[model samples]
Target: MTWQTGLSGFLAGLLISIVTAPVGVSGAVFLLPVQLSVLHVPNPAVTPTNLLFNVVAGPGALARYRRNGQLTGPLARLLITGTVPGVVLGAIIRVFAIPGPQVFRLVAAAVLLPLGLWLCARALRPAAGDRPPLTRRTILGLGLATGTVGGVYGIGGGSILGPILAGRGTPMTHIAPAALASTFLTSIVGAATYAVLALTTDGDIAPHWILGLLCGIGGLIGGYLGARLQPRLPEKALRLLLGSLATALAALYLFQGLNPSGGN
Candidate 1:
């Protein structure tokens, strides 16, 4: 890659980290599109590359949550336990059940559209005073489902899980931190699964060593900044921005599905 490409990736990573920090997303929604559209990365490689970014970027945010005592240990453990298995399965599916790029785009649209709308609705709704206690079963179930999606899409999966937890009355304070921790753990699993698949199926599918290093450098800086600034942002405005961006990305993927000739 040229210096220009490196600079662009670095800046993009920084900006995404800043925007998504408040919302508890790792910013794969933003990064994936940029990788495809601007970097001209191929579809098959995009998920893995994004996963690489997540792997590099997730730990610092998780560490921040841990330091602040925001993360719920039981909830995080349950989420990781369920999601790890699902991530492995999803990676297998990515290799053997490899859908056409158009089909994958369509599926991505389906998953992200509803998630985006839900975020928007939650933002508009009034917050209740009391939140229900987090449970093992529910967290595990949600983790399993979201992990599969994240594994396939190469995102943190918190993009889906975060809103659900909030809607279910998890406090934003706890939800954001726990979700970030969960995303970090699950991302490690997903990245490993993808790495295994990439090695067996297509050695070139994910150039892990190079991409991982670059993404890590960017993610580390961004994650640290994002975690530091999380408390100051207005929740409603943050949700609106995140939801809007997710919706837009879903629409862009949907359009790409429809117009294969135009290219992503």
Candidate 2:
């Protein structure tokens, strides 16, 4: 890779991670499109590559949360338990069932579009009184759905989960730690599932280690700093940022699906 491209990626990773990680996103929510449309990375491999970045870069925010006593081990365990099985099942489906670009586009557009809109609504709507607590069934169902989307879209699912929890009036403290832990765990399962699929499917889905690490280094530092700064930022501001990012990307994906000739 040219120094120019590498530098671009580093800066982008740093900026995006810093903004997104504090809200539970693993940053691949933004990075995946950049990789595909700008960096010209192919699919299958793209998913795994993004997951690798999550694995590499996730610890900084996690560490911060742990040190701050916000990690919530029991809550994290509940999330992981629900997400892992779905992630495995989804990865298998992605590799074996809907491997084609056109189909994948439709699936991605369909899933992300609604989630993005939800986030936007949450960000804009007036604050309500206390929301009822989420049930165990509800959490597991959300986990299953998020894992499926993550497996297909090459993300850790925190971007979607974070906004949803925030919308439900969950405390940001519990939201950040719980979502990050779940995403990190799901990403690990997603990457492993892709590796196994690569072995069986006659495709090369192995991560681009050098590029992943380059972006990851920036993400690592950014995550830590962002976590440190999270409590200081306005809640509305963070929600708007993630909400806008998700909707923008969702629109782009939808447009691309509608006019393949117009896409990168």
Best by lDDT: 2
Residue 221 of candidate 2: its Cα lDDT? 81
Model 1 residue runs over 4 Å out of place are 128-135
The RMSD (Cα, Å) of candidate 2 is 1.6
TM-score of each: 0.91, 0.94
* lDDT values, one for every candidate: 0.74, 0.77
- lDDT (tens digit, per residue) of candidate 2 on 1-264: 777767767776788888987777778878877777777767666778788878877898889988899985566776777777877877888788877665666677776677667767777888888788788788778877887877777776655666677767787888887888888888898888888777778775777777777777778888888898898888777877777777788778878878878675
Model 1, range 168-237, lDDT digits (tens) per residue? 7776776776666667777777777777777677544663356455765687678778777888878888
Task: Choose the strongest candidate by TM-score.
Answer: 2
lDDT of the structure predicted as candidate 1:
0.74
| Worst 10 contiguous positions by lDDT, candidate 2 | 156-165
Model 1 lDDT, residue 216, Cα: 59
